[model samples]
Target: MREFCDSISSYVSKQLKFSNISIYQKLNVVMSNKVYDLQYKCQLDDNVLVVAVCYFTQYLQTQQINKISAALNVFSTCAVLASKYIDDDSFQSEFFSDKLQIESETLSQLEMHVCQALQYNFALEQNQLVNIQQQLDEILVNNSNTPKMSFLEE
Candidate 1:
């Protein structure tokens, strides 16, 4: 029954040229790309990606994501925190400001939002990381068919 309903919805969405992709799926793709870009641009350790994904997921659970902008902000904030927390590194604020077209100060504000949402605790146990890994795997499988959307255009 669920599959039938989804197929009907997919068909109607396609017929009307509406996006069938859910916001969460879009966020998943955008976040993965952002993490990859960070890895390439910052020469970051692989652990940073892991931490960022975990942090972003935790943030999502605590907050309601109603807009793409909010989702992106959380991702950027999580990425910055992950870099700082795991590598003792700072965000290349200028680079981010240029790319995100927001003031460097906005990053700080976003970071604070994420920190508060996460209760200011950044610690992660081995079991927590393992659980996060499983969650990520699930997201990957579920989002496999997510149609490509331009994050910038959203």
Candidate 2:
């Protein structure tokens, strides 16, 4: 594991520094930090992470979720989808359940929600990814939450 780079690292750490952001923004930082941990433990590829983030962001646009449970459900579900869609050796639900403490059935349902939200559209373009990153950067910069660099330090 490597560092998040100075710019992204500063922005991410700042997410935890402020206390005047919405719950959505707080969960975004949580999801971001959790994904970093999952990537290290699950040995996920950059492509899988890209797809996961895309799925998470798109699902949020269509759903009216407002709980940590729902947030983690979507976050972990997106990771499950991305790994299966993009990786040859995909992970199992039990792995996520064990790591994230979400039920396997719930993750399955959340997976269905995201897939249906996009009609099973898992493909992502470079421009779309760039746009997503920029959007997250802008939003996260304005948000506040503490993120630990447990996986890797810069």
lDDT to native, each model: 0.58, 0.61
CA shift at 132, candidate 1, in angstroms? 1.8
Report, for all candidates in order, the number of backbone clashes.
0, 3
For candidate 2, write residues 45-76 as lDDT tens digits. Answer: 55566567677767766765656556656666
What TM-score does model 2 achieve against the real structure?
Answer: 0.66
RMSD values for the candidates in order, in angstroms, are 10.5, 6.8
Q: Which parts of model 2 have CA positions greater than 4 angstroms off?
A: 1-29, 133-154
| C-alpha-based local distance difference test score of model 2 | 0.61
Q: What TM-score would each prediction reach against the true structure?
A: 0.64, 0.66
- Distance from true location, Cα of 148 in model 1, Å: 25
